[model samples]
Target: MTAPTPIVLLHAFPLDHRMWDEVAAGLARTHEVLAPDLPVALGEPLPEPALEHAADAVAGAIRATGPGPAVVVGLSMGGYVALALLERHPELVAALALVDTKSTADTPEAAAKRRQVADAVQEAGSVDPVRAMPDVLLGETTRSARPDVVERVTAWIGEQDPARVSWAQRAMAARPDRTDVLRAFDGPVTVVVGDEDSVTGTDAAEHMVAAVEQALLVVVPRVGHLSAVEDADAVRSALADLAQRVHDPVA
Candidate 1:
């Protein structure tokens, strides 16, 4: 008889573990949830139009924290890192929960934008890019209902080390598309999105669910790309469902 495994939460770009405060409490009732911040960005100027290093950075975090395989929950940039973690250390992740993110690489145009953002963050010595970034990342409807969520999210991003912020941008811009990660995983998977999420819509969530035979997708209406914080209840319920699935794969 072994104790239950913990649930692991990975934070999005320019954010630390704080992003999952609501989620951590929600999941704690039944499952142990651990949230680790992404590395603070610092160091050399970002590579032009590329951001592959963040993946490696995230993989290191996963390996260091786990005593055994843990259910991995990742949001936005965190989701990208989760994909890379699964690819690099498959045995460490028992399941994956991807919220408001897709498993695809950046397009050339998207990559270029990433570089521009990195440069701006580096020059300004701030996470303003991350703060302003959500406008495009999340939907307009969300901003209308949950003004606090923006502050919460922006704070997470703003606190980031400018280099970490810049580095994360570059890392994301450089990584390969991860659709295959979804297509290949056989374990329990949860794909959640805010109904109002125009950045990565429900369509992307469904594609991920379809890719993994055992995957489940939950859409939180009136919520935006930051579904975890925007609709904590929806996220909690979904995690509970995922926990049950992991606990009883045959069911």
Candidate 2:
């Protein structure tokens, strides 16, 4: 039998590959999984973590995953990088799974907010703004019932390097609309989101699904922005389903 295609996992802002630990572990039994720690999470200096730069880096990592097309899975900021990779190197991707992310560019007001956060990080020498993100990161159900998940997310945000956080903020602020990229992709696409995700909710997922001819949308109930961590099983199932589609296009 042929080996399964590799699954390249791109992580979100201020978080490392650890965000996909459980999902990767579950998928690893039957697939090759590549979850690289993005530069922003490595405490490395990034003058500007532009999506193009990050996408190039991710492409390099995907190329290193052996000689075959791979399924690309990304969340939040990772999704932006994924779309960039799709635009720049579609040959490397066999399928795509985008979780809790949007294809729209930041509005002027939203861009200003991101720049302000970047500025604050530079001024305070810490990711203090992210430290207060639990309310925005988790759903009310997850916050009130899943203390462990909330704690894990808070810790992840707290551990982000101040400079790297600033770089990510700037990079995200500069991202462009990628709906065209999505519409052009011919491979299988899976758009997953948390029902309670206020950051990029059901509407965003729906929009993405509409843009991709082969896209399916999965909504994880009682979760929020960090759906993978909030509901790893559901997220993993979505990825596994996409992996099947990637490996067997006729199936």
Per-model lDDT: 0.76, 0.88
The most accurate candidate by TM-score is 2
Residue 126's lDDT within candidate 1 is 79
Worst 10 residues of 2 by lDDT: 39-48
Clashes in candidate 2: how many? 0
- In order of appearance, the predictions have TM-scores of 0.87, 0.95
lDDT by residue (tens digit), candidate 2, 64-174: 777787999989989998999999999998999999999989999999999998999999999887788888878889999989887888898899878778888898999
Question: Candidate 2, TM-score vs. the true structure?
Answer: 0.95
In model 1, residue pairs whose N, Cα or C atoms come closer than 3 Å (at least 3 residues apart or on different chains), thus clashing, are 40-164, 41-163, 41-164, 42-163, 42-164, 51-170, 51-171, 51-174, 105-177
Expressed as tens digits, the lDDT of each residue in 123-223 for candidate 1 is 98877766786676556776777677777776666667887777777878888888897688888999999888877788878878888887877888887
Give the local distance difference test score of model 2.
Answer: 0.88
How many clashes does each candidate structure show, in the order listed?
A: 9, 0
